[model samples]
Target: MTATKIAIVGVGKIARDQHIPSITRNGAFELSATVSRHSGVDGVENFATIEELLAGRPDVGAVALCMPPQARFDAAWTAIKAGRHVLLEKPPGATVAEVEALIAAARDEGVALFATWHSRYAASVPAAKAWLAKRQVQSARITWKEDVRRWHPGQEWIWQPGGLGVFDPGINALSILTEILPQPVRVTAAELQFPDGRDAPIAAQLQFAGASGETVSADFDWRQTGPQTWNIEIETNDGQLKLSSGGAEMTIDGKVMMQEADSEYDGIYARFAQLVAETSIDVDLAPLVHVADAFMLGRRIVVDAFEM
Candidate 1:
């Protein structure tokens, strides 16, 4: 079978670090072209914009959109309309409604649409989900704190209105939670802390309630400097489950149950290939919906100015 000709829509840090490598290693895809304003992949045809790339690369059968959530909807809509499969990075779109529209467009075009949550493909996430499915969850706590300067660097778009700030990483935890838990959850309360002069929040605390009456709380902060942490702990009828290192490790009752190197992007590309082959859409709106809910219902507080 001929490899699917895929074009990457963004050539930012994520596209270079993860998406490029994953695509190169996966036999189901070929890096045929790139759409970027400033950078391009070596040995691939480059275009200054998505419109130009779409028009030029008629052989391109799919597109992987690694652009910011704010710009994702337009590119995705265009690709779906062009009858090309699309793979979207986490936090699919700027809003829930936009992703819903993309779903409808993909269906109308009869093409695959995959909204990938890389954290969901972490090595231990499936095992953690399996373990929780057999047990009764009593309560859950999520703590995801990291230094934005170290991770995001000089990306100014992150502080903009639709950039999603702290929720960028927080949504990853929500993705894992939504996938592993047996019942659906809804946000009950949220407190968002925004740094002065920034449009988006820098930290957030959220309370959630599951249909089974289970309570889950999350604390997301982008101000941490030392000892960055990404952890989720859950209490069950049998014992306690803890997933640390951003789902890279899992422990039960303080004993390590699973630990391994993460191949999240690899898994993401593999799944995208499968979705493209099946001509199915796998865009889950649960995680993005929860983020939107938190922003809608949460109270905002202005804090100190964050200088990067």
Candidate 2:
């Protein structure tokens, strides 16, 4: 099988840390080019903008957008219009509407559009989903707290309006929740805690309701100092299910079920290859929709200023 020649439009931390390595290891893809003003891969061709990349490398059949959410729509739309399959990083776009528009544009151009949720591809996520499918969920709780300085470093875009702040990492848990739950859920209430001068929140508390009267609550904070936490616990009639280490480990009522290394982006690129081959679309907006609802219904609270 001939590998799909692909270009990555952003060369930031995630691009360097996850996307590039995954693409290199995946036989289905070749990292032919990149679009970044400040950086590029060692051997790949680089362009300053998406327009230049799209026009210069017409043979590059696919594009992976690892840019921030605020600037993703235009680049993705440009790639799709240029007849290239597109793979979006999580929280596909700044708003739900723009992602929807990209879906339509990809359909019109007959190209694949994959809005990836990397956490949903974790090693134990499938097991959790399968177990939950057979049980009656009593309630669920998500406690996702991480130090932003450690994960994002000096990336100031996160504190901006479209950057999603705490919800940036929080949405990963939401993605897992949407994937594992037998029933759908919607946000019922939220309290967002914003730093004094920031446009986005540093912490958030959310309440969700399922159709069967099951309640879900989430607590997300970016101010955690040590060890970090990314855990989801669900109470069921049979037993308790818990997923920790961002879904890399699963425990049921105190027994270790599954544990494995993080290989989510690999699965993402693998799925992208399949989508590109079939010329299909696989954009799930359930996670993004829950974030949108959280913002719309959340009450804002001012907190102390944050600095890097």
Candidate 3:
């Protein structure tokens, strides 16, 4: 089978670190080109803008957008209209409305639209989902904290209006939560802590209610300086389920059930390949909706200024 020619827009840290490598390893995809004004992958053609890439490389049938959420809509719209399948990075768009619009456009164009939640592709996520399906959830707690300097480094867009702040990482936990739980959940309340000069919050605490009245709480903070924490503990009628190491490790009743290396991007690319082959849309807005609800219902708290 001829590999699908694909281009990656926004060759930033994520594109370089995860997307590029995943695409290279996947037999179904060919890293045809990239769109980045600053840097490009070795041996691949680079365009300064998405428009140039679209116009120059019509052979590239798919485009994976790794840009910030604020700038994602326009590129996604352009690609969908150009008859190219689109794979969006997490958060999909700056607003839920934009992603909704993209869905319509992709339908009209008959191109696959995949809003990827990489965390949902973690090794043990599927197992956790299966385990939860058989049990009744009593409660869930998400503690996701990491140092901004360590993870994001000098990225300033995260503190901007559309960057999503702590929800950037927090949404990963939410994605797993929404995926594994059998019932739907709604955000009941939230508290947002914005640094003195930043437009987005550095920390957040969110409360959610499951359809069966199960309580879920999430604590997200970017101010953590030491070892980062990304864990989700769920209590069920039978026992407790804990997913640590960003869902790469799973434990039941404090006993290790499953653990694996990080291959989330590989799984994402593999799924994208299937979507592209079938020309299907796999955009799940559940996690994004939860983040939006947190922002809308959260009480604002001004905190100390954060510096890199």
| Model 2 segments more than 4 A misplaced | none
Local distance difference test scores for all models: 0.93, 0.96, 0.95
User: Which scores greater on TM-score, model 1 or model 2?
Assistant: 2
Tell me model 1's lDDT, rounded to 2 decimals. 0.93
Using lDDT as the measure, the top candidate is: 2
Tens-digit lDDT string for candidate 1 (1-308): 78999999989999988999999999999999999989898889999988888888889999999999999999999989988999999889999989999999999999999999999998889999999989999899999999999889899888998899999999999999998887788999999999999999999999999878899999999999989899999999999999999999999999998999979999999999999999999989999889999998999999999988
Instruction: Give the poorly placed runs of model 3, Cα more than 4 Å off.
Output: none
Per-residue C-alpha lDDT of model 3 across residues 95-118, encoded as one tens digit per residue: 999999999999999999999999
Clashing pairs in 2: none
Per residue, candidate 2 scores C-alpha lDDT tens digits across 117-232 of 99999999999999999999989999999999999999999999899999999999999999999999899999999999999999999999988889999999999998999999
Off by over 4 Å in 1: none
Clashing pairs in 1: none
Question: Could you estimate the TM-score for every candidate?
Answer: 0.99, 0.99, 0.99
Question: Residue 241 of candidate 1: its Cα lDDT?
Answer: 92
